[model samples]
Target chain A: MTSAPELVAIVPAGGAGTRLWPLSRRSRPKFLLDLLGTGRTLLQDTADRLAPLTGPDGLLVVTGTAHAAAVADQLPQLAGDGAANLLTEPSPRDSMAAIGLAAAVVEHRHGPTVVGSFAADHVVPEPGGFHDAVRTAVEAARAGYVTTIGIAATGPSTAFGYVRRGAPLEGVPGAYAVASFVEKPDEDTARGYLATGEYSWNAGMFVARTDVLLGHLTRHQPTLEAGLREIAAAWDTPAREEVLARVWPGLTKIAIDHAIAEPVAAEGGVAVVPGAFSWDDVGDWDALGGLLPADEAGAHTLAAATSAGDNGAARPTTAGPLLAIDSPDAVIASDGGAVAVLGLPGVVVVRTGDAVLVVHRDHAQRVKAVVDALAAGGRPDLL
Target chain B: MTSAPELVAIVPAGGAGTRLWPLSRRSRPKFLLDLLGTGRTLLQDTADRLAPLTGPDGLLVVTGTAHAAAVADQLPQLAGDGAANLLTEPSPRDSMAAIGLAAAVVEHRHGPTVVGSFAADHVVPEPGGFHDAVRTAVEAARAGYVTTIGIAATGPSTAFGYVRRGAPLEGVPGAYAVASFVEKPDEDTARGYLATGEYSWNAGMFVARTDVLLGHLTRHQPTLEAGLREIAAAWDTPAREEVLARVWPGLTKIAIDHAIAEPVAAEGGVAVVPGAFSWDDVGDWDALGGLLPADEAGAHTLAAATSAGDNGAARPTTAGPLLAIDSPDAVIASDGGAVAVLGLPGVVVVRTGDAVLVVHRDHAQRVKAVVDALAAGGRPDLL
Candidate 1:
């Protein structure tokens, strides 16, 4: 093996999966749920997918301090059977901070000829195809352009933002120049864009050389630029906490796409690799069925009663203590106690030891209301 | 006050409440659920409801051996704190055997003239109505006729059997001759019968001299007749188990309505007090809400969850440790480990330490299927 290209993997494992509730609690988020009961969690699966590409020592994960222990425990392949460079944030400041921090660490350690920012909570079924896209993007990143792995739009998914591809960049034949970044669009507009075949779901996976990413950030978001340099100077250096505390909260809470990637494209720089390896952010409850081997009629246990009426069985004559019963297309999770839903569709039920929650799944995007109410009521203990 | 009519309240606290599963188990049946948390179980509530009518010495309860302890625990008003004359069945025999045993004991101890049979699990909202009906039925029974309290039919309820009224019997003028008995009819036929205004719900509550009931049993169900006499011969006498074992299972599983009430009505001899009081067998989960305090949308709980829409101020939240968000018309009950029901309607979710059950209120009739499955799976340890 005569010197294969140096690979660096930046794993962003942060979001508190509130939409997947009950099972995905504040303490243990969705990446930890045994949705498939395959004895591996989502974050572990993501790490396994990237293991062959980066090898053990080259992978670094950035997460909040609250989840550091859990993230370390899940990624067992790390050096000394411990998490390799488990970067902990002082607080949740969103993806821009996480990616920038990861970039700084990778540049300092590996000289970042090519770095892959992979979401630890994503589900990529065809690992081979995902590897191919990562390989192609690595070639493009070597030519000094920031590359994002654009998932071929499967349907008009209004839940995710979209990226419109422009003409192919020079020297990278199959990759297209990024034209514009679209915020989550309405259903009809999403459908229209899907029909045109020039748009893809923003899978949040990005590839770039150290110089290209830092250059893009410096031009578009100077506030993040200063913070990234400060955090980088203190990397494995003392005063790390003091530096992070000064700059992390001061930066605007925005995704890297909005702050840096999209602006780089507008300034005629960013590129896209349209690949068909089947990817998902694993963002919500509805996304689980596609990622795992579900029972016929498509149901999985998130600690809820799963009755398959599609099997033509009479009233789901299954044997077991069913924690809760729900209508078709509903997601119910219980702690063997607090949350039980009956005749509900498109809803999520979550039960913690002290608090139980029931929310309409469609309105699941509004679950922050529950947290806000609890917090406003001076019950920080519940939050 | 003039001596109250001699009232003997023979409460039948038998039969497993399988329809209210998880919450209502073999160890803790529906009568034990603190549905209203009114400092009483259903058995306790039933006894309390009859407190004014039956003096301390007049209340007799009949339950199986397995549940005698539970029954005793619930009602403190019965003899020996409601345990005296608590006739436990030789085994898991049906209601007819339990009723016969009660009749034998009542006649042997309190004479044949005035005894009333009431079901242990029901919610009669108007105690005054129940009191009036009980008094009237007692007067009518003393006049040498069997008197069953009949609820005025509210609608065409296909769920319950109906009793047809005939001519008024002599001396008990408010009581009518029971012209006939009808099984649960088809919806259309039930509607036709209801329109005629000549039928009432056969609630299985009856007031009759013990001798009169025994006579009717002898004329109709001779197996019940033989069993009753054997039970009577061994009454308060020794060698209880030996005699009960020989006679109990031989008694048919026929209900009192089919064995005695129907036969007497066929002969145009029985009468019913036009009972203005309401009654429910409390037969299934759908029937439970009527007996409990329900909100405007008719939701109740051992534990329940309701939803708050975009305008959070519109939803009234729970007052305890549990939190419910944006759920409506669902019944949730928990001992404390957090039960949350999301978007659901007319359903029951119950959680106990060992088991959890979920079912639609309408399909609650099939909860016994789940129980049977649990039992058949050779987990009587759980059942």
Candidate 2:
């Protein structure tokens, strides 16, 4: 656990999560929400999972200015290390800048150490399997290979990208060279990938030496790297606000997958650590229903949205009462009021304080249409 | 129009409307609710329909003691005439006792006036045709026949009883001799009845000379008629409560159709006055949905339950807010909370203050199962 002297874990928290709208709002994003009805929010859960691997002062959280306070509020340990441990982007330039800023800042404060980027809103149910693969990924990262912990696929799910693994690295025992990173495939293509048994779900989890990441960024996204480096130079000082105000707005807006993982894997500089932990990005209500236990009616009910384990106070906003009859496989949620469902199997009901959403599980991905409709319908408060 | 010297209108208000549970409680029966989202409660609407025919002093409402205050509160014109106008039975003894008592009371007060008994919960839209039919029915009643207004059938509905006309009465124009009074028919039988062009929906709208109706009751249900006469004799006096308490529960519990109409029609003492008014019993959520206009999503949304037409102040109970998406033909009602439906066609959702129900339209009649389960499951408050 204490093998790497300067392996800092970085968390990139963002996204409006529009598909999970009415529950996931702009002011209260998904990362700060207990979507699974679990006692800990996704960010807090992410912090707990990495705390053992990163140690007390070795974890960093980079979020937008809007959610910075909430991110720190959920994970108070990030606050103890001062401004250096919690990086706030003035205006979101997407994942490339968010992660590069943290990597550059970590290198400035503690030299070019191996740093890992994990999303603040992913679900890794058990810590043991996650910890094991992360340890191997950290070893590969220390060995100067850009590494990622690829989740072992449970099905031919087309919602997430896939990573192909090749021959094992000479020095790193379990880490294999990542052959390529592919886009979200069609269902049949995903089936073919699964049949090959050489592909894992690309969970956007990347671990690499700070020097190696900065080196790849210099060769690929050079302008984005320079702006992040400028902000990192003044990050621990009073000049941080001034430099961030000047450089943050102009950083290249690209995901870490497109900027680093995909191209770096093609260049033989990336390694894949196969992770056997049960994982889900929780892309929609259908996915969320799959994660929850079914009740007597075979419907998944959302309990009071209280995070009991994270030392957070019980919120007044709750999932309220639900009476479901003959509605097998339906997901019913309410905001401090009673809801009833009958005969509508696989229906998704999301009743919040201001807006309510109802969609079939088969059309869960199309909830974005309702969000878009609300926006066009002069209901910005709902969005 | 006012040829008959004495024409009294009697309204029998009862029935918990178990199919519309939570909305129609023991305390707030279906007759007291403005279910169609219109400004008039069913009882108030019935009073208004009969008011023009009965005049100020000619209308009497026969309800149970439990609903006396609400009945008087809803129809203040009845309050103007004191306890005589608002007759409260000690207990429910079905339709025969309620109507027979009203008829007996009319004979005692007005000496065998033609009294018409109309149920408190049937919807007769456009009262022009209804008033015309009642006027003709009163004429037939004055001619010594136990006259009933038979509504023209809109479809082969199997929910209501049917009456077949034999031939036009020799004395009373537009009145026909009833050949038979049939119970609710099966779909094929109802379709056959509709094809005959002589069958009409038996809407429980009976108009008869109080003496003639009493005579029919004496022949068919003598004990019930004697008990009703005894109570009616003391109805306006201070001993009304005592007489009701003694005789009401002991009277035979039977529907008016079984007690007098069926047997009397078989004996050629009954006559049918054809009614062309649009009519509905609104027997269940599906029927109620048919009565309400569809919104953009083709769902019938229940509005605030305010009887604006009546002088009574609006009760706090309301159907609340609803956001429906892709839920065509859904019946969604709420008691002051937001409800949303998505992707379900013909679904019925009733969310009240204490309970909620969700059932598809095809299963509307089966809602009694949920009410039964709630009773069996120790949720009597919901029932």
Candidate 3:
């Protein structure tokens, strides 16, 4: 078929920024946030970072029903032609179903090409090095192997999953066959993993030939394979959407790492390419600050209207009407109402139209607590 | 004139909650605030506190032009017969002008009756004790003494002025003649003042014969006395509003403590009643927690709908939505935007709609630094 397309990119931009609340809500997810006002959203920035690697040819985006319009609106440059493929999920199944959905679509359209799955909410400052790492993973993927990119461990951060590097691949020097996959480890384990040079962060960036991914899924997860077949067979049929709606809700709520990569590594043939660029999930408010320019006090306000001088009057000096303030070391994002961080440190304050949230930054992972609370309170309207 | 009316209560209620920021705005000064949600405002409570002392008809309110309507709206009981005797300042001239103008009006109408000058913003919890103290001061005032009630110093609080208790007056047993008035002392001097039994807080609650206050002002500050006479002459005349408009703007912006109390004390003859009652200016957000019913965690909030349930998901399980979340030892307040506190001890976070202020609670007196910064930036609107 004229030598299947050289490179394929699949971006899943569907994470709700519960941690980044107030500034990010169900209507506005983290990927669409114009954090730092760099004139580009995290999704656009992710798309831009992968642009050179795919060579202006092939890129695809799969997002949830809520975020599809926003994804399409933000990256207008990828419009007109079929250069960007935007797909929508039928329901809120986890990343496994999302990846499966995108992989099936990519395989149907692009055939046996190499596919790179990237999260839309990440930032890789060094574009050229990231592009090179993706190229290396693509090279490994072409050699009949499923490849994943592992970021070099920066610190003993207990917040992310870890990948253990195995035997070196034949053609790629930096590429290693993944020894194993580990879930987010405890602090001591993370420190241990960091001390050993064999471990790197499981950045969720993966590259695999379309056929290889399908084969891995069929062998390891028969239910997912069956669902994919059912979805593909009824593709142009009226039952397509309904079948997905039926099947997706039943699929296991698991990450691609747990469903596919760990199982593949258990069989001992997966390869890993160490990423060359600086990468962060932009996971919390602290992560957002690392990307911004700060003053001598180490305070970084997301409310751009607030700077040193405005902190005194507790008013915004900027014309945008500062809706938030002097919450040193806290991340405050406001949409309708103003939020001020008085003497608050290491906290997240969010002010939406009807709901306002104040939480400790470290406990942000538990913001699902608020979501659960909202649901139990029978206020799905808030969610 | 039938021995004159016994007393005229000068209720000073002119301050905007500027230092308290967002919550305490131009429209909602500290006096108008429902701080403890007793359903009575600070001003109404102040008026109610004085009601028993001054038999049904001895109250007058002096407030700014913007807040006159709110003052009248809240204190309707005090204005049962007349127009509330609500005197409006064309603009904020300072406490000296407000007090002087009130003194002039009281003198003209009530002749030489004892004038009990009470702050609309202070909270005296023990009404019985406060009335007894007022009675003692009125007795002193009728004897031609400018009687000031001095609070027993609780701690080394640099936020308030200090009064050194001198020898006792001949007839006033529990009262002491004034030695001198000290400006807000430094921390060291405040500690020294707290250590000695001879010093007390300049509670700003004074009882004086109308003629005694006017005479003291006329002797110590002739310019301000002239301005007061001009403002008084304008009353009940066609040229009254016009002359007050011309004269008040040019009057020296000074606190009565500095322009009159200090000089009067230096000249001797002022008497101090050892007043016993819980008192607070309810100065900032940090101060609100003490005024209101704190939650189990000693947290206070000002939201329309608040439910602190352990089982609620939308709200925090451990800590709730705090307008200003001052930590274990920190103090923070806001007008109503989102405010948070983290990792800070003994700090004060204040969020004004116009500005955000963060300072240690002990250093709250330095809020002027924020005001100064706003002024330096040419932002008079915030100031």
Q: Candidate 1's residue-wise lDDT over B67-164, tens digit each?
A: 77666555544546335557777675565666767877777665674778888887776789889888888887887677888888777988788888
Which stretches of candidate 1 lie above 4 Å from their native place?
Answer: A1-5, A79-84, A238-254, A290-298, A302-383, B1-5, B79-82, B219-227, B296-298, B304-328, B354-359, B372-383
Structure candidate 2, residue pairs in collision: none
| Model 2 lDDT, residue A246, Cα | 86
Chain B structural similarity as TM-score, candidate 3: 0.81
Query: In angstroms, how far off is B75's CA in candidate 1?
Result: 1.8
Q: What is the TM-score of each predicted model, taking all chains together?
A: 0.87, 0.89, 0.86
lDDT of each: 0.69, 0.82, 0.70
The per-prediction CA RMSD against the true structure, in angstroms, equals 6.8, 3.8, 6.2
Question: What is the DockQ score, from 0 to 1, of model 1?
Answer: 0.33
**Candidate 3 residue-wise lDDT at B227:** 93
lDDT per residue (tens digit) for residues A122-177 in model 1: 77777998888888888788888788989887789898889899998788877888
The two-chain DockQ for each candidate, comma-separated, is 0.33, 0.36, 0.23
Error of 1 at B368 (Å): 3.8
> How big is the positional error of residue A208 in model 3, measured in Å on the Cα after superposition?
0.9
Per-residue lDDT of model 2, residues B158-233, tens digit only: 8889999999998778899999999999999999999999999999999999889999888888999999999988
User: For this target, which candidate reaches the highest lDDT against the unseen true structure?
Assistant: 2
A181-300 per-residue lDDT for model 2 (tens digits) = 999999999999999999999998899999999999999999988988898999888898888888888888998989998888889999999998998888888988898789888999
